[model samples]
Target: MGNNKSLRDMQAEVDQYISQFKEGYFSPLAMLARLSEELGELSREVNHFYGEKPKKSSEKENTVEEELADMLFVVICFANSLNIDLQKAHDAVMHKFNTRDKDRWTRIGEEGEDENGNN
Candidate 1:
């Protein structure tokens, strides 16, 4: 809809995570650090799950919420910077998926599977 997203939009996208954050709940710098931390955690989890990295002692302990929060915070921030509504954007994407992919991907899972019940 616009040429490019703005910094304020990014900030708002991220800030949307804190539904009731107080004035002192966080600072810009803190949010940046938290985002990086969450991204790192997610990367580590992915490596443990599907990459070559061996699992850490706490590897099984997934910080899914932390990662989600971090992602949403940045997303809201980005959206706010560009005056984009996440709810609307998300809905649009879902609508597209529902209409276009419902049938396209429905049978993709069997592409690699054997046919006629043969292995």
Candidate 2:
């Protein structure tokens, strides 16, 4: 963890990087495809590290953290291209989870509740 940066900062950084290129950001469809590709890479890394799937000796070495960062970069680019504020989107998602999904799960050290709202 180097210097902590906000989502806005990350978005700006990506925008600046894309600005230098003649072809700024990819189209939404292309970005989505790229996102899916990154996701697949991340999933493969996770499977190699945690799941039963093991990497072959000839395969190139990679870490889950690196794959996650790659995914984040693509996500930031996608968000920036759409002019969507990730921080605001995150806040809204958090709000929904906090309110609508509150009590949806059991708390540690506390008795679990059933769907009927029983103890």
Best by TM-score: 2
**Model 1 CA deviation exceeding 4 Å by range:** 1-40, 49-52, 55-62, 107-119
- Model 2, backbone clash pairs (residues 3+ apart or across chains), number: 0
Q: Which ten residues in a row have the lowest lDDT in candidate 2?
A: 108-117
* Candidate 2 residue runs with Cα over 4 Å from true position: 113-119
lDDT of 2 by residue, 4-104 (tens): 88998888888999999999999999999999999999999999999999999999999999999999999999999999999999999999999999877
**TM per prediction:** 0.48, 0.90
* Residue-level lDDT tens digits of model 1 in 10-117: 555355644456652345666577668778877876776688987767535775566676676665654554556776787889999888786554264566555453
Q: What's the lDDT of the predicted structure labeled candidate 2?
A: 0.93
lDDT (C-alpha) at residue 69 in model 2: 99
